[model samples]
Target chain A: MQKRYCAIWFRYLLTDWLAIRKPELKDVPFVLAASEKNRIIIKAANQLAEKQGIIPGSTAADAKAVIPDLKVFDFIPGKAEKLLAAIGEWCIRYTPLIAVDAPDGLLLDISGCTHLWGGEKGYLQEILKRLKGKGYYVRGAIADTIGAAWAIARFGKEKAIIEPGGQTEALLKLPPAALRLDTAAVDRLHKLGFYTVQQFIGIKRSALRRRFGEQLLLRIDEALGTAAEHLQWIHPLHPYQERLPCLEPIQTATGIEIAIRNLLETLCNRLKSEGKGLRVAILRCYRVDGKLVGADIATGRPSCSVDHLFKLFALKIASIEPALGIELFTLEAPKVEDLMIDQEILWTPEGCGLESPQLAELLDKLANKIGAKNIQRYLPVESYWPERAYKPSLSLSETTTGKWRAGRPRPSLLLKKPERIEVTSLLPDNPPMLFIYKGEKHIIRKAEDAERIEPEWWLTQSPHRDYYLVEDEQGRRYWVFRSGHYDDADSQWYIHGFFA
Target chain B: MQASKASIIQQLQQKILSWQGFASPAAAETKRMGLGPLEDAFPNGVFPTGAIHEMLCPTREQGAATAGLLSGIVTALMKNGGVCLWISADRRLYPPALLSFNILPEQVIFIDVAREKDVLWAMEEALKCEGLAAVVAEVREVSFAQSRRLQLAVEDSKVTGFLLRTDLKKLTTTTCVARWQITHLPGALPDGLPGVGFPRWQVELLRVRNGNPGSWIFEWNNKGFVPVEEPLAETEQHLTRQVG
Candidate 1:
């Protein structure tokens, strides 16, 4: 296959990323700024900020002077590189061979992959349209070589592609800067009256190398397919695993516990050395009686703690019968990620909750003993929609997405589905004085004011719920709500949750 | 020769008393398990912590009463913020409701196993965890020998085990510290006013290997359980009908 290359340039990557998370900042003038020793310098500006004469490489003061009400944000370090690497990963959907072109670009080898998308033109259009829909300003070009594709994408004035073997002719029309030569060298050539690649094409290679260093000739060679360029493909993380063979076929529960502990130690050591942690593992015991037993352990956070892992495994050791005897044990970490630093111990041991690690160990034990789906921890999502107000997090160490906007108190236990109950109320909007739930009648001894939770008008068509915190005669607090208005005598009232 | 024989006899008697847990170590380790007046029947005014106790509820309707009684026991045992595990084939425990007894939801872990085999396997394993305050297991039937296995595990770990026998008909016999039955009773409204009242339970001690057995009426209000002098005497059918 030919080494066909495609380069994508994200011109306003930082600005676009900011706007994607915050849609209200689309037309507003904002700049992503980086502080260097107390000096705030603008790195990238949104489309509107650019139109207002704010550009990169200017100080925040200069940008604000241009537009007084400009909003500036602290640029997140390594965010651009991470985004480019992520795009390099996503580009695997286009072609298997791809690499990061750095700062704000991705390179993909699309030789045999173009036909799958109906030729290079449709492919380029599709890629551009998809990225544009994601709020990114992009320019893409495909050529026979990566150097040629990169030069043409950023500097070429013609079509996005050069005809086969016609790159040299196309290269002649573009300026010397298109070859990726240093800025100093390009300016020197401009002063020497050699402004375009066509002027240098007539000179001998040796003469050009002696007059202006070898870098100039190498750049030109690389751009015209005379020199080779390397591309690095993104690879996924491999699963971590370990296996152990027992010399003796043991049948006791104690023997199985020892085998599981040994397997955990070997697997966890490997994970720890790589600065990684495991979230899920499979421990399999093969009995000599021709039967196999396996137990799956999942942790609340990415952890490689051998002791904690061993305890979770010990809970299931009783299930392995070892009918005749067991001979082999294998442990594989199927889910792993970079280790995260949970908060340090700040509170007393007998505090409201356990320390993060202690809590993680406890959750892992519970999840292993019980079913995984029965446990959940929710973090607030940045939304006003009721259903989207919070999202179940995968790990306990995940940083909060946004501040949990406080309103009225929420119940600790919410029913899977709200159950409709029969309520007796004195006034139209008053709290229910008596209600029957699950066939038991509850009389409200005390009630708080009705807390109205209106639906997000732009997102849904559901009726508003007016919730009340009512204490039953047994002194158990319940969260009950009346759906919609009370003009009808039989309006639906539901028991939503129980307050601890 | 008579003095030598008498000394050997005294040594054997002391060893037997220690084995029967009538000596110093046993007396020091036994704790008052918050069984109100029931503690007076034991050798010391305490309930044994390193022993196995059984609570049998005959039908599904009585499961809630047993759970409520167990929640109070767990709260008392886990005074130092220790954890408790509940293992069963079908989990119907509403954990948030236990908060009424000052037992936080996070302090308890619930395990539901589909196989009867795994239920005992997990319970036996949990009983061996000295870190835990107590282990409550719900199984239909546990033979006397199986109870002995659970009892042996607790003896080493000093973890209290509650074997809640959901199927009460198989009351063959087991070597347990005591056996209890919790039945839901009609809660009396103060002055006969028409509203729901506190949780009232009729607790019966069916058998005790080494202590006296009797029955008591307990009223669980917000301030915890309080013994009532007179038991509520309504027919059982009337109470089941309200819940059904």
Candidate 2:
């Protein structure tokens, strides 16, 4: 069997960004116009404007004359590029092998992936249905070559053509502009009575090459798939997935737990079969009543054990509301790696290592049961102030130990915020003599001055602090401090943190 | 050899006697005994696993500190790899106190839902989740039908469930193995201590599966709740001093 290639073109309007910003003008006759010097440049004309006889590059004045009710808007280049990138990201769900065919299109290499959505026709139907649901008018095409697909999507008989092993025949019906040639070459071809690609192809190749140079032949060869063309396909960073389609919609917690276990079993089996372990897996539940609920868990290390994975899920299953009913369950291993499986040696002493996956599972369960933001790993910030020394991380995957800065002695528990204290002591540059905190006055029987640390002047406007380890009259010790230098105004007293 | 054998038998006998009062490491680690002997008489010698322990208190207007006492006990238990699932029906749980109690915000999962019906449903789901150490569910009133469902779910999962009943008037006839009425004790003044005064609670164990119901006063200490034993003896001394 001869090998054949197919290119899928995803065409989007260049001016869809503007349409999104002004949704009211979506179906209206609108033209994107730019002004250069004193002349108006028409960048793009929407389908509604095209039906009103306004074409791209027509002057703003000409478009108004052509259609008296035409809506003209200024063109924004950078904004449109950002919007296209966002659309490109959403398109990644269909195929990981996606490349931005700049300005207005996305090229997806759906060769082996089309089967995932049932086939080429089904895939196209799904894409069209989703885009239309989001209020977009799009055109798609699939052919044996990128050039042929591009031409078909732009100027084919019905705006979408599926040509299999007929790139030459497909291009013959398209206009010279469909070859993606410059405007001058298209006009030159038009003047030479070669209006259609078929006319150009019928002429002698050597004569055409001699007359129009080798560029024309290159374009023709590219459209015909005789020349080499390269497209960069994006590889997703992580790619392990398992999907479960429930015959009966699951509404109860028991039902969801069963589905979770089934999905985890399949996912772990796949991970083990591949000799790989998953580090992160996301469980997405599509509720039948239209709500979407997702639970994510990250292992400290790569793991493929079904029992361990289900334990992590057990901690999080309570947070997932089965809502009306869950119709589908999907588990995706977005992160994976080859794990080192160690064999136990008899009579050999094994060193204890932290079970990272267990810790990560614990954290994941807590985050799910409580809330994602509520459970965070504290990373030490490079600051001397106790309150500013630690920062919370959203995921436990971030290493919590090495990130801390050395040099400062940190308390195990730091107060969320500093408490103010009433201090009356005669100390110009030393520790306080008396202080009252939590409505109890404590006389300092003995005190030792530790260190006076100043804030980072370049980053913050906070004042310097003089810290003290003071023993109260009752024998209990406290860590207190006075804010700001004595020379600076508003040198007040505050109890910043506690050590227990 | 004969003397050694005799000593070994004596040690075995001692070990067997101690085993009668032996507590699981999980129980010891969670500070279960610190909450006083009244709770220790029940099954498991503490809050029985695989059963629903209900805490009833009047409305917030009536100064119910049920959540505070429950939080303290739950926080102590959380140290032993046990998670606390807090299910709230109407009121929002304060986050600051939950953090201070050493219950990592992530450890206390709060389900802020509407309607008592949904709260009961969520509670049943939480109780059935294995590996969870305990579940604290707050509801206005748990109907007899709902309580039966919860009892079955707890028994199946073998996880402890605390049903915090805010409505003290509408008591369900369905037995929940054990029920406690929690009331706030009067705050104490600082007694020459630099730190804040200790918290207190007056607890009345109204029901037990196979034990007698009684009331007790507990002082919240650094470790956990300590029983105020010999309350009459201490009160008599005060009365004599007042008469003198």
Candidate 3:
């Protein structure tokens, strides 16, 4: 058996081909003209205009002579890049090792995988046929070497691969530009009566190297598979992604649950084999009705057990409605970490029952039922004032322990807003003697002074307050305060906060 | 062995007093009854857990601070990883300000909503959550019909819920375990500093399930609240009354 190497080159049209084709300009002459106003250049040209001798890099006015009434559109670089990315993503169906040749092409390494489609020719036909059915015009070529395949895809008469050790004969009729040389080098070769790659091949190797430099000779060598060309494939940072395509659509909850269970089993097995566990899993069900329903669950720690994952999914299954039946199910573990594999000491005998994980799972279920934001965890804020010492968070995921402040005794219940009261007492150094609050008056009976908590000057510029607990003639107690510190001219007593 | 009738009656009274003060070993098994006193009552007793209680405030301003105090009581009870969910349609709770009462922000979850219906829905959901220690829902207007629904929901979940109504007059036909109206009270001043005294509020326990509804004046303290037992002492009675 002969060894075979295959390279699948994919191209993305950066232009809005659909918008251009909608005006019946698909078969009409059109040139994507670039402007010098901001140093932009024409990026692509339609086939009709290319046939009319109006090529890319030609000035807009010059192209107008070849084909008048040429429609012009403003060039948007960002949109073009996004469209290219979408195309690159779509090309993932062909090969996993897809490299973005940016702004317009993809390089795929489909070496051992081509046999799945009965060889490269059949695979190329299937891909082109599907893309054309989706209203796309594509040209593809495959070869033993990436350089030869790339050259043949762009300029060869037929979009077919050049067999192993046959690059010289296969590329003979092609122009020198097919060698993937720079524009200047190709023009230089053309000037030297070397229009065809065959002419270049006929020249003496040493003379070609001495006159045209080693770069040109190296291109020839690379095209003929004599030199090695390495390509880097883009790899996702996190990888436990599995996708299942069902031949029969599943709409019932039971059917979806079964499919989910199968996927979870496969995913957990993969995690165990890798000595890793997932912290977060996202299940995306692509419905045939064109709606995407996604359910995501996060665990406190990395876990690979099917039961654990199923419990989390159970909390969120009600949220996912499999409308119009789901045709594809994809489960991705975007976050994963190494599992803790240490054994507990026999002497200590760690509690092996369901404890923390069970509690966390219960909370997750409640959160899913009553919206995530409704379930909150409180984190203590480091503040001297009673009401300023804590904040509410969505979950216990945020561990901020060092922020807790000790020593001061805070009230169990603090009023949301302090109400103003009429107090009859001297200022600067005294607690209230008699105060009327909420339209009632009571004589002071007994009282105790709590320490004054001054606001942190660095954090906030709030005034100092003297907090005190007092009793009334009616034997009722209240938490009240006098705002401002001594000696400040602007210091005035304002009811700051109340304690329950 | 013959004795006078009066002397025999006196001996019988002494025996009854001893029996009432100290329970016999056999009587101890029969649990003392007669409905324990109110938890806040000085001589009454402490409030029992797993029981429903209520407090009502007549005015908005008076009720606001009292509500905070009630939250403090809830927080103190929730020492064992307990949580309180505050479902409200009217009041806007600022988390930082509530921390002074020693209520951990994590322990109290405030749900601020716009519609009255949503407030009831949130209250029902909070009550259903088993981990929560208690739920306080503030509805501007809760009808008797809606209150029945809430009562049933809370009963089913077996969680304590505090329903604070800004419009006290609107609570016409709902059956609550207790009702209270907190009113502002005059506070005593410290000796010789010449400034306004600390604020005070009178909590009126207007209704109770099996106890007497009476008002108690409590002085809010930094450490905790203390009931004003001697509001009318002889030494400063005239002076305090004049100030009031």
Error of 2 at A121 (Å): 16
Using TM-score as the measure, what is the rank order of every candidate, best first? Answer: 1, 3, 2
Worst 10 residues of 2 chain B by lDDT: B22-31
| Model 1 Cα lDDT, one tens digit per residue, A1-500 | 66788889898998999999999998899999999778898988988899888888889999888899999998998999889887777677888887887788888889888889899998999999999999999999988888788888888898898767777887888888888888898999999999788998789989998888999888888888989878777784545878889899978988888888888888888888998999898988888977888888888778988998888888887777888888888889888989986656666343123333654575577678756665444455666434466665444445563756445545544566788998999997788889998789988876678888888888788878888877665455677898888875545899877543
lDDT of 2 by residue, B172-214 (tens): 6765878887654433345554422344455678888655587
DockQ of each: 0.12, 0.03, 0.12
Better of 1 and 2 by DockQ: 1
lDDT of 3 by residue, A1-500 (tens): 34344433333263335444575766666656567775445556666666677666667777776668876655555665566456656767777776655555556677677778897778878876876666555667777777777777777786476666776787888998888788888888888888898887978999988877888888888888788877666553446998889998888888878888899999999999999988889999999899999798877567888986886787677778887889999999989999866465556322112123433554454444455665555677777766666666765546576455655433323456666777887655666778877678857666676568788888788877777766665544556777676567765444443333
Clashing pairs in 1: none
Q: What TM-score would chain A of each candidate receive against the reference chain A?
A: 0.56, 0.56, 0.55
- Reference contacts reproduced by model 2: 0.00
Task: Assess each prediction's global lDDT (C-alpha) against the native.
Answer: 0.76, 0.67, 0.64
The C-alpha TM-scores of every prediction are: 0.54, 0.46, 0.53
User: Model 1, residue A218: displacement in angstroms?
Assistant: 13
- In what order do the candidates fall by lDDT, top score first? 1, 2, 3
Q: What CAPRI grade goes to candidate 1?
A: incorrect
Query: Which of 1 and 3 is ahead in TM-score?
Result: 1
True contacts kept of each: 0.01, 0.00, 0.19
Indicate the residue-level lDDT of A349 in model 3. 20
